[model samples]
Target: MSSVRLLIGTRKGAFILTSDGTRKHWDVSGPQFAGWELYHLKGSPADPNRLYASQTSSWFGQVIQRSDDGGKTWNPPGTKPEDLMGPDGMPKGESNMFLYDTSAETGKPLTTHQHYDGTQRPWEFKRVWHLEPSMTDPDTVYAGVEDAALFRSTDGGKTWRELAGLRSAKGHLWQPGAGGMCLHTVMLDPGNSQRIFVAISAAGVFRTDDGGRTWRPVNRGLKSQYELPDPDADVGHCVHRIAMHPSRPNVLFMQKHWDVMRSDDGGESWHEVSGNLPTDFGFPIAVHAHQPETVYVVPIKSDSEHFPPDGKLRVYRSKTGGHEWEALTKGLPQRDCYVNVLRDAMAVDSLDPCGLYFGTTGGQVYASADGGDSWAPIVRDLPAVLSVEVQTLP
Candidate 1:
C-alpha cells in the first residue's frame, strides 16, 4: 500500500503531489514545466520509476528533464525539443553545455583563483541548485550549481560531468553567500557510497571521501560572526542547510546563516545546537525519517526579517539532538504569517508515521503525516516554493 510522491519545486512549475498512503487525500497533478524554473525534483531511491528535473531558465537555459513514467512524462535526455532545432528550423534555444574545468588539477584557470577582493572571476553558467538522485543508482545523478560546481550523471539525465575535484579542491577559497555561490546542499552516505556531503552558500561545508575526487573544508566548529572576518575561518560560512540520518551517517544537521548546527564527527566539527531555539535565524534543516535524535527547523524572523516569529508559523522539534526545541503549532500559521523557508525547501518521508515536508516563501506546501506533531496544506497557492522532494510509491 505504499504511495506518496510529492516532488514539488516551484517559482513557476513542476509539481506532482499524489497520495494514497493516506497523506490525506492529495492528488494534485502539476504546473509541470509550464514555464520552467523547477529548481529541483528527485526520485530514484534505486528507481521509483526514476525521475529527475532541474529545468531552469533565464529565458531558456539549463534543461535536464527526465522522468520514466513516475513524473507522467518529460524529456530532454538525449535532446528533443524539436531536436534543439535551428537554421530556421526554430528551437535553437537553451543548450550551451554548462562548462567549468578551465584547466583544473589546479592548473589554474578558474580565472586563476583569487577573489576576496583580489578579483578574477570567470566560470559562470548559473542554474540547477540541487538535484541528487542515486542512493543506489537509478541511472545515478547529482548536480548542484550556480558559481559553485559539482555535476555528475550516470546516464539518466542525459549527460553531464564535472566533479572537477570540487573546483580543483579549493576553487581558490570560495565566496559569495548572499545566495549566489549556491551548491545548495547534497548529502549522500547511505552508509558510505564513497561518502559525500556538500552545502555552499558563502562556502561552508564540504566533504568527500575519494568519490568526488577530493574535497575538504569541513568548516570546523562553524561560527560566522556576521559572515566571517575569521569567525573561525575554514571557509566563509553561510551553509543554509544540511541534514543526515541515513541510520546515523556520522550525524550532521545544520541550518546556518544564523545557527542550529550539529556534527557528531562526519562534518569534522560544528556545534551550536541553537538550543531553545526561537530565533536561530533559519532556512531549512531536517532529519527524523525514523528519528536519529529527531530534528527540524524553521524559525526565521532574523537576517533582516525573513518572516515568522511573532507572526507565528513555527516548526522547531528537536528531540534531544540539538539544544532542545519544540514548537510544532498544530496546523501551522500562527498569525499574520509572513513566510520564507528556502534551502531546498525541506523534506522527509520514509512513511510509516514519519513524514514532514515543507515549502513557503508564501506559496505554502506543508505536510506532516504525524511527524512534526501536526500540520497540513498539501499545496496552497503554488509558485514561490522553490524545492521539496519525496517519493515513496510502490
Candidate 2:
C-alpha cells in the first residue's frame, strides 16, 4: 500500500508526519531544528528521499538547508550557516550565506523597488519564502526570497546563483504588500520545462517562457481598485496564492487578497470567480489532485481581521471551478473559531480519493482523506504553522 509524508514547517521548527494510505493514524516526528524558523520544506518529485528547507532568523539571516535522506538530517549547503562575520573567510565569504547581494553577479547594488508608501527602497534579503525542487532533477532547485528575488541551485543546495533576470520584469514597480514583497509562489510547468510561473505579494504574478533568462508580468484582467491607481495595472496586485493541477498547467486558480480568480490560458489573463463566496478575502488556495475543476479556499472575515467569516472555520469547495462554492464543515469549528490559514499552509496529496491538508495560525493542522467533503485534525497544538507539503511515497 502507498503511504504519505507530511513536511510541516512552522514558526519555531519543523515536523514530519507519516501515514499509510488510510491516513487515519499518523507517526509524528520532531521540532526538528528546535528554535529555527523553517519557512518552507519541499521534497523532490524526482527523488522522494531528497528534501530542501528554508531556515531563517532576524539576527542570523537566511540559510538554505538540505536533507538527502528525507528529513532525518540537515546541513547548510555551501558554508557554516551561522552569524559569524570574520576574516576566517567563510565558504563564499558570505558572513550571512543567503543575503541578497548582486556585487558578485552584477557588480551593482541591489535594485530598489516601490514601497507601499510610494517611496523607493533597496531590495533586502530576509528569508526564503518558498522552495521548488525541479520536477525532473533531484539536484536542481529554486528559491524565492524576501524583498523579492529568485535563485537557483543546480548542484543541489551546495551552490546557488541568482536568476536575476526576474528583476527585469518590472522589478522597480514591484512593491511590498503586508507580507513584505516576498515571492511566495513558485510553480513549475511539467508540460514545458521552459515555462515557470511565480507570484509575489502585492506585485502580482510573472512568467518566464525561456526559463530564468527573462520574465514578463502576466497580470492582465486583474483589478485592484483600492490598491492601485489603475484598476487593472500590469503589476502591483496583492496576489495571496495561486494553484494549478499538473495535468492542466494552462488552467490556473488564484486566491487574491480580496478575490478568488481563474485563468484558462495560463497567466496570460485572469477573471474573477469569487461568486457565491461569503467573502473572497482569504490566503491559501488549492486544487484537487484528480479533479482539475475542483478548487478549495478558506474565506477570512477581511484583511484587517485574518480569522474566518462569522468565526466559523469552513473550507469552501468549488466543484465547477469558481463562481459556485459549497462550505465543507463536517467536523470543523462552526463558531468561535478565529484561526487563519496562510498561503503556503495548504496542500493536497496524489492518492486514490485525494487527501487534502491545511495548517492554521492557531497551530492546528487539519486533514481530509476524501478531498474536501470532510476533515479531521492530524495534530492540534504546535508552533504557528507556516507551510505544509505532502509527498506520496512508493
Top lDDT model: 2
RMSD (CA, Å), each prediction? 16.9, 2.9
Name the 10 consecutive residues with the lowest summed lDDT in model 1: 106-115
Per-model lDDT? 0.82, 0.89
Q: How well does candidate 1 score on lDDT at residue 278?
A: 77
TM agreement with the true structure for every prediction: 0.36, 0.94
Cα deviation of 159, candidate 2, in Å: 1.7
- The whole-model C-alpha lDDT of candidate 2 against the native structure comes to 0.89
| Tens-digit lDDT track of model 1 for 228-345 | 6789888878888899888888989888889888989998988898978878988888888887998989989798889988999988998999998989999998899998988788
* lDDT (C-alpha) at residue 78 in model 1: 58
- Screening candidate 1 with a backbone cut-off below 3 angstroms (N, C-alpha, C), the clashing residue pairs are none
* Superposed Cα RMSD, model 1: 16.9
Q: Which parts of model 1 are misplaced by more than 4 Å?
A: 1-4, 8-18, 24-63, 66-70, 81-83, 87-96, 99-182, 185-229, 232-235, 238-254, 257-273, 276-323, 326-354, 357-368, 373-394
RMSD versus native structure for model 2: 2.9
